[model samples]
Target: MGTTSDQTAQHEGSKAAMGGLIVCPVDLDRPGLRVLDSGTGDGYWLQDLLGTYPRLVDGTLVGTDVTAAKFPKHGAPQPISLQIQSITQPWPSEWKHSFDLVHQRLVLGACGSFPHATAVRNLAELVKPGGWIQLIEPDQTCGIQDGPAMRDFIKLVTWVFERMGGHARYAYDVKRWLLDAGVVDVEERSVPNYLGARVPDADLARRTARWTADAMMPLLKYTEGHDGPIPIPREDLQTLVPRLHEELLERGGFYPLRVIYGRVPLAKE
Candidate 1:
């Protein structure tokens, strides 16, 4: 999942299916536009945006991650910068209420390490008044109609995330959190994503399934509580992955992806 090729493909695939990067519909040509992508893995999303909206090269684009090691080596156009920072922690004081757009995708793992409310508030704090904050995350609980193996896999995923203080239901609760943070004009949409080649976009579905299978390995191997050296055991994955992959290839097997966006209320004049 850390590979540049893999990240790039994921970014492109998601963009193709979910529409453009930011959902708030801001003019890309707007001057002094500041954008922040928290947990910006591989910086692919920001890079794509900069490439597509060349005018944004003059605006400030920042990508933050826990480490800069996996950041794309090729320098982006001017005004693009990368910082090593944890999204779960208190952000720089200067950054508070500074960004025109704050985006975070698939950050459940990192955000789960801390209080969900705190994390959501930290992300909201970065948006300027009337600016937008967007979040995209998968519902890890289960697919639309999972088979035995797929069900088991979902259970394992939930167990692991819960053990690590994360949640599979974070997507569902994000809207409420945004509302509490004084965000307005909140809107959310969910896309049911098929894991196998049974969908119209067969290749995309299959590739996504395979990518998900590949990503689940390390997660399954995670050790938890004093139960055993191996939490679920590696052998289980060896048997489960293939079966789950096959299950996904069939009809009625899909996961839900939630996209939530809201605007920070403008300050009273």
Candidate 2:
């Protein structure tokens, strides 16, 4: 009972999605770049990056999410363009090997089961010779551990996502896929989510509770397609929120977030 593509796009992995955006600010410095992207919900990364480096006016960009989004706000010598597309489908044949960079970030189940190899192959095929491709995913191990809220939160979400037949653990070993795809000069970086990081970050914790509720709703109602036992109740979602809130504040508070990414030139020099 997860959200439709529209609603689910909002919370790309907490830190995993954000980490994908952490691509080298250096990529923006190169001239005349063309970037093909995957499932960019808000397009904040491109909006902020083009603004960060006005010289990138010579660059071109296109983004694809399952659904459309308002064009991002940016200031640059050239306008940034976005394209919305389905993750499960084949490439739009005309655009093969066309982009200077291909990036898929925190798409989890959307990238396909072998997200590591399959997604990497997709990105590699889109990049022009000498161009590059990058993949960013999280290994939520850092964010998980034995604890009250932490343990409960993990169990609930994992159970819900896994049951849905979707990826709840794209974080682990995403780069291995990149390497297998023959990407060269590959590199990786890991960063923490800083849960409830500061006052501003507290909202992250709240939102997660909301998702847990949404994830569970589908599981409970869909079993046996109208004949199975009610595994969970609507009230259960409400009950967890307050409990999750309190757990985030306890000492040694949860920090369940980490991102790893890899990048490589599309062609050998």
Candidate 3:
């Protein structure tokens, strides 16, 4: 887990690159519409969506996570409710086939605790027939021009996540998961999250790099339960932070973010 500041920085970086609250086209005016944001960190994405489509105020909007301490107070015209729930477990029976739009972003790290297929199937079960599901995750396999330190960092982190029963590179498989879960018309859009100081938007890139470095700090200290500590030392991680930034500054250095979405098939389908 990362600090609040680190998460905020990551959100800002993602928002700058992704261009909106979400990439999927939602019909805010649909009757009895309901929206659910699984792993809704700080509720920013849901807030942005509600802010953009004020008409959704009439519908139910819920954000669920393992904790509600970080959810923002909702004074928006439509109330955004926060629920404390874990994505790995089965959702409430009432929630099954209940939402018009289900959104989850950057939850791969947490979802890695369970089988990817099971986690995704649980999310898919929350959508109503013909509703939409949108998932966004970083393609861990696709970092650009990684330096030796960054390379080592990736290797270490990947190993740590796998040891914890999670998949670090799950983003690359999201579309297939949705499809296997019976979603239709699946669509995928990949965006380059430019990092490093040489990109056109260098300020955002720098902040993103810093956030990435900060987020990885915990993994540096992580140890598999019976195995000794992860090989990377704290000092090495500290040194790698600046080195990562420097690497990103080189030409064509960026991370790829993939947004994959699909619609729940209508019953007749």
Candidate 4:
């Protein structure tokens, strides 16, 4: 249960890891561009997008999540329409084929409860013909440059993911899912998301460490309650924060995130 600010910081690290706010080749300068960020925890991505491409102010920018409690309700530099929408469920009929871009990230938990392919199809249907859909998900099966502690942590994560009914490496099949949903020209890119030590930017690394801890602590609680097989001793779960600090501060590791995007086919003339 990461707080809104913590989630926002995690997304900032994600953006930095990906190298920018956008990875697709879509032109933001296009007039009347309508963008949708599904599972927008706090609308930070929408805010960043508007800041990066000021012209979008004239267009529609919408952010949707299952809840709106975290949405920026005041002092937003740009206008953003926030909605309570679940990507795993049906969307409003009026939204079909309406957006120039549909973006979703870190919805692996939702995927646990719903068919991921169905979710992909739902997102694909929202895109205008020739528009794009982008998905960013962590490759939880393993980490990049993982030290002993990180490797053990990944095992715990994989265990939790399986318990939730989702594949630990679900990201690897996203391209196929998009293709099955009739999207074309699909492309996938990956980058290492650093959480601690070794990051050239000290402040960002520290922020990422806090974000990671916040995001995982709740899961660790769940693990602590369960009486099943686990990667580490059940009692040791209480000391996760300090262990994470040492792992991140001493030998730093990174998780890999995959960015996948594809375009909807235009209607035949």
Candidate 5:
């Protein structure tokens, strides 16, 4: 049991179907595939799907992350026979309706547009008739309508997200965007982050540690990357970690997350 960064989201078995470790075979066993991986962090899953997937090595996989250089730093070496492509545009026009599967994850919006839903519409257009689109996302500052952390856990980052025209509340309502984009038979599944998942798995425990460290590192020093304002001070956020950890440990944070997806079942030309 070893830990890998961003390998299948830090959700332990939360992303059981997409997470790293190859605990199970990730083969989609479908035909005529042209996959577009949005937000492909360090190429973890893509590498896994190609090398160990046992079912998709022959299909074409186009990988994209927030940036072209977001490839993962470590993994059990990937396959030699997979197609990889970089995407930097808000959306790709040339690849419309050309894929059997379209995927996006952990995206930050740029402009006021609903990238969450816009991406869905774009991916929908990219999928050949009867294809599928999958999206996964988690918000670090998850809050309920009246939760203790909604506005005061550390500080207000809501304005920060708005400053850059991004959606701070995207996670809770993202699936709405997918449905409006003509994606029928939508299915939404929620996977919360439980400190319990780490209770016995040394690997997951380690990953949890790193994630906590990274979040508390006052990552605000790099606020320039976010746009403006550090939102809550790094010191403030760091201070909350111990309490947050303790609370989650008491019953695992079960942070709300959404994995919403849909299928285009009608055949298209």
Candidate 6:
């Protein structure tokens, strides 16, 4: 449901919300640094990392997704490898423990069919000893404000996620998942995400609103066509997007997020 421009806007918004491209304090200039981005939609995260640190041009950067449909039509940015991969399945044997950093964001929807903890464990296996594993996820359970329509939207989305077998509010438990995976020095950073007038920047607010609306459209349509206990009825679902946007613009909203990271323990340190 997200266009390229919409994806770009959301990517920039996440960067602004998190305050930087790389958040784990890992050295980007290190020679031969190896990095992996799971569920790399359009390879945006990998592209931004290389663009931010030109010295990493020689470093090995790879982005993987379950499919290549969203990858750049021409090719991934120079020196970045895009592959077809599913985080729930076994990765290439050669890739085991090969990356200095493993990163993923907003992919809980993709992990809906399986336990997210298992996916996290799979991602952790790719990190080299002493390397970092970082995950950024949207928090749907708290900080939301204004708009009964928006509240219904959240409820419908949460129902969809739960029906698909993933918890919509799984971000709160990610630190324990990392700890169980044997990752050390775990850190969780919370960031305030404002939509509509809640954000000081008007342009960003509008773009974020559009992104939200676009994302909700497909889900709304799905619920309308499918048989489920959707919070919004089919007739109301038809007008929900416009109402949600109006509420966001008039009253503003907050959707907090989490940036969690930790280092895999070094071998026999």
- Name the candidate that leads on TM-score: 6
TM-scores of the candidates are 0.86, 0.69, 0.84, 0.92, 0.69, 0.93
lDDT of 3 by residue, 64-147 (tens): 888877765553235688778998787999999999999988886776567887788889999999889999887766465656
Residues 71-169 of candidate 1: C-alpha lDDT, one tens digit per residue: 757754467788888977779999999999999988856665688877888899999997899888876656546777667677777767777787767
lDDT agreement with native, every candidate: 0.75, 0.53, 0.75, 0.81, 0.53, 0.82
Residue 20's lDDT within candidate 2 is 42
| CA deviation > 4 Å runs, candidate 4 | 1-6, 75-78, 141-144
Q: 259 in model 4: Cα distance from truth in Å?
A: 0.7
Please state the error at residue 20 of candidate 2 in Å: 9.8
Off by over 4 Å in 1: 1-4, 199-203, 224-234, 246-253
Clashing pairs in 2: 1-218, 138-171, 139-171, 143-256
Clashing pairs in 1: none
TM-score quality measure for candidate 1: 0.86
Query: Compared with the true structure, what per-residue lDDT tens digits does model 2 show for residues 1-269?
Result: 12233233224334343554545433667787777667665555455556666755677767677765444444222456666676666778877767776766656555434334565577667767666666655444434443465555555555555556555675555556666766666666655444332214444544544443344344344343534333344455445555554554442234343333344453444
User: Model 2 — which ten-residue stretch has the worst lDDT?
Assistant: 1-10
By summed lDDT, the worst window of 10 consecutive residues in model 6 runs over 1-10
Winner of 1 and 5 under lDDT:
1
- Where is model 5 poorest over a 10-residue stretch in terms of lDDT? 17-26
- Cα error, candidate 2, residue 117 (Å): 3.0
Candidate achieving higher TM-score, 4 or 6: 6
Comparing candidate 2 with candidate 6, which one achieves the higher lDDT? 6
